[model samples]
Target: MAARLPPGNQRHDGEYEDLLSLWSDLESALSVVLSAPLRVQDFPAKVRQVDRWLQDLVAHDIDAALYLMFQLASTSSVGYSASHALVCGTLCHIMAQELQLPPRERDSLVRAALTMNIAMTALQDVLAGQREKPTAAQQDAIRNHPQESQALLERLFITDNLWLDVVGQHHASISDRVPLASQEPHDRLTRILGTIDRYAAMISPRKSRAGRSATDSVRAIVGHEVDQRDEVSYTLVRSVGLCPPGTFVRLDNGDTAIVLRRGEKANQPLVASLLDRAGAHHARPGIYQTGMTNKPRIQSALARSAVAVALNHRTMVRLGVYAAAPHNSGLMGLVTVPGAL
Candidate 1:
């Protein structure tokens, strides 16, 4: 059953609707650029336009951007390459700000991320839907795609050496023990992009397997078992939280909730419960701000495959906006602010 949002939540705000529309448009625009760069008249200009669009989207409201990105990545109707590029590019943009990367370096890093897999675009889409392991030839192609992508960009008249070099070495391995600040500019960006690339891929699903839960994915990247957290991994966790919005969590009280926003604290995200302890759908999902006093805390992250709720994401996003609104009275006993908790 589709759980209805509560009465006041039924309506959408114009700004929220605009944000959704903007994201949808950006997705389409990016798909065009990534899928057919040769066909684009002014390729570099087009890339910049898309990058500016992404920056604006992220700057407008990062939580909304993450909510939409994770939701698309989990259940993408588009090709895997495009979806993956968007996720990587978005993360790069966010990381740039968090890492305080200089303007030129950030530009090169993000552009490289968006174009890194261009050489394998079709193959990537095919691989996502193929249950079987990659063939030997496909493996070879994947191994060679980074350099090929760089060469292709050069042919397309991209004269940015930093951008080209970053794409070429995006898959290069640097010692994890090395400090990011000590590396050359290109190497630092490469390390940052490489870490974001892996993290993005792990959370996205494919026919071959279900994607890991966000927490598990982060744990893998952060190397929690070995207790060696790289700067990129630490920054990622600090910026996006262990479970960002658009992911799911199991609560201590036995309800399954979808994350709506990053709370004042990372672990205490604002979530809306779709299923009760009995595993039945609720008529109206209950909103809970977890980690307040610790009663209804999150027990663990849930993989998108683990929960089968079909969400009305716009409505969910609206609930988040309302929760953050300055003048909103608490709805259905909802706490308006995490601080209030």
Candidate 2:
């Protein structure tokens, strides 16, 4: 049975519809850019498209944009490169906004996040499906991917110094003994991207293992070698919360649910119940405000292996937990935002 939004919840049909359209357009553009054939000429145009989408995204409710991003991350059929780019971009945007960065700087940070892994897109996809450890050659490629990606962007006529620098330094460790004065002006942005990239990858399922629980992922980030004392790390943690969207959790009421959105409180979030107290699937999923009462609060974040249910993009869209366009109009149906072109 398809899940429905709770009865009293006001439907943001128009907003969600727009979000769906935007998501498809961005996904399609990213697919072309990341394809094996290397559409080098199309790279610049696609970045512009992503920039426009980011602009429009910030104008909407932050939570709505986040929900759309989570839906895309969970449902995308694209390989790790594209999916990671999208997720990291969204996370960077959220953190930047929370930290009150200037609009120009925020947009540049998102652009950096989106293109940071372009050079390794295909390799990442291939590596993700393998159970064995990466080969020696693959290890070398992973180590050099940041510089290689930046070089590719430069060849594509990307002239933004900040964007290029952020991509190049994304993998550099803050825990290194390098002097702070030697760090680039955009070091903060790089650190934020690095943190988000790692977090997103940890929570995303791979052939080698199911994704870590959201709580565990958060813990890993806090315990990272790079000091967590920076404002960027603090804001990233605060914005993502303990139970990020797309993570599954068990409720105090004995129902299993998927997180839909973060709440005012870090421990609480909005979730859609997939199972009832008796451990049976609901005819229609129920939405709960975990912060409203402690009785139905999230008991613990569950790993992907623990959830046996099959929830795909179409089902999530049908449930209204994720946004979707009314028809399969592809990129043409996407509404043009002012100044996007």
Candidate 3:
């Protein structure tokens, strides 16, 4: 969890403290080739080094791990394969906490999430960037990715079959059409990874302009995952959607907010609470509790529809709110909106 500040000064502290550092690590790692040659060379060693580092960090700070993973998921472009692993890790952390999953299970979940896409860095970059679809070479690379990722995992001595299974079957659907010898069970990791992969593919602004808001994106992803064959998909996607990156919200008491962080708890969207009536600036790291209610009562109610109702930027604004306005005439925040006029 982030260090908490007192009630009134919340606006000053911002969330995602280590976002840059995490981004640096993510970009740096993805910059290297990890498929065949690199794997044969020393990329596997580098991958293990990073994983070991992350594990050491995770033992003490899951929140930091989550923060790192979230930023990586939202911004990293070297490859979605790598991006997928990070997103999965972030989702697992948040989901595990919400589901009250066991610690060992949570650890396993995070480990699997991180390594799932290591073998598909090429395809990952294609998905993360505006690059052309994986070429015949990339396609050939992909069909063999399970083997590639597994081979790397084995080389790295990653012990869990659970990790291998999710990493291997990520693109595989349960159609009898697949000549595969057997199938895997529906569980936390599969659900989390599946959803993260689909959502990442959809919201990639690099993909198209039909860009959807956080809520809309969640709705769309959840809808896509609803078929009987895709219940786990639905659950995972729905869970992640609860707090898409950059989600803005309002409290019941006329406060506007933005989601700066997402915890393992699907219901709670970690928000940066804006204190000013106009919402020009927010208390950087202000976080209210998750769910409909909170441990400590929220002082102000956010106005969702209020934004639509042109803020009465007019001078002599609502006395109760405008009392603190800079000028006696009434100045909301720094500038008055046309609506105020």
Candidate 4:
């Protein structure tokens, strides 16, 4: 389970505390929706509530939102299905802004991403924690989950045609070369959601195997396409840097670091080094701007499963806040508590 903040007295300030509280609340809200949609009095209203919460979190700080999302993806106590949905929905929300998608389409698109796997939520959670491959019945269920999900949503009174269509066809095979603008609305949304879904899945860990590195996950998605101008995939990478916040990496100088924020360039990001070149943990992580001249560059992405370290997330986030806006020198005075996460 993701850690929670202590009493307000123990926290440095409201900034980090509020961000962590928002993430915790979001996970709990989503857990309820995905695990038991029927239990919700108004399914559509509940969805919109979750969406607004997500928007608030993202608007507060996109980097911080991504940081928490990736952190949860690595160690989700709620369940894999919920974590995956949150990642996909969050990415879709960001991509919607990049694509300048209409508000209506963006709403349906993000809602679809959140509920696309509703039909198999229980099964997905089980599969994520199990070592064995899917049984034949499980395979059949997986193959038909899209259609089933749509039907389930309908029963829950989701009457939005665009939402229903996108959920039902999110797994459809579409030509990557076709420009997103020329495609039908449902088709375009489906393609976008599918891309994000696959990318999020590739970077999320499961009991069957360790998740791929963020760099490798992007390559696996964009490499196969012959079209260099694939709108969704390109915009996705542009919106979130190659090594997005909360992901780990090895530096050219042999230090292992965690990404804190995106830099001026997509390839370069602000990172905090946790270990030195000799593989010894630093007493306190040293922040670096990989984009700066003569600075150590990122050597490679590290899969979450590959790195085992407990971080006082509160301290790291304070450092991020200070790094993003150096004028906030007061933030640096926050207490550094150990074993917070």
Candidate 3 worst ten-residue window by lDDT: 312-321
Give the alpha-carbon lDDT of every model.
0.84, 0.69, 0.48, 0.85
Q: Considering TM-score, where higher is better, how would the candidates rank from best to worst?
A: 4, 1, 2, 3
lDDT score, residue 106, model 4?
Answer: 98
lDDT of 2 by residue, 45-96 (tens): 7787776776577466555566566655544335667777877888888888
TM-score, every prediction: 0.91, 0.80, 0.54, 0.92
Candidate 3's residue-wise lDDT over 99-126, tens digit each?
5566666666666666666776666656
Winning candidate number (lDDT): 4
Q: Which ten residues in a row have the lowest lDDT in candidate 1?
A: 332-341
Tell me how far candidate 4 lies from the true structure as C-alpha RMSD in angstroms. 3.5
Evaluate model 2: give its lDDT. 0.69
- For model 1, the superposed segments whose C-alpha errors exceed 4 Å read 1-12, 225-229, 330-341
lDDT of 1 by residue, 1-341 (tens): 22334456534555677888898788778888878889988899999999999999898889989999888888763488888999999999999999899999999999999999988888998999999999999999999999999999998899999999999999998766788889998899999999889988998899998888988998887765423347788788777878899999999889999888888776788898888788787766777778877458999999899987787676778777677666666444432222101
Q: What is the lDDT of residue 71 in candidate 2?
A: 50
lDDT of 4 by residue, 297-340 (tens): 99999998777777766566756767777555444344343332
* Candidate 4 lDDT for residue 320: 77
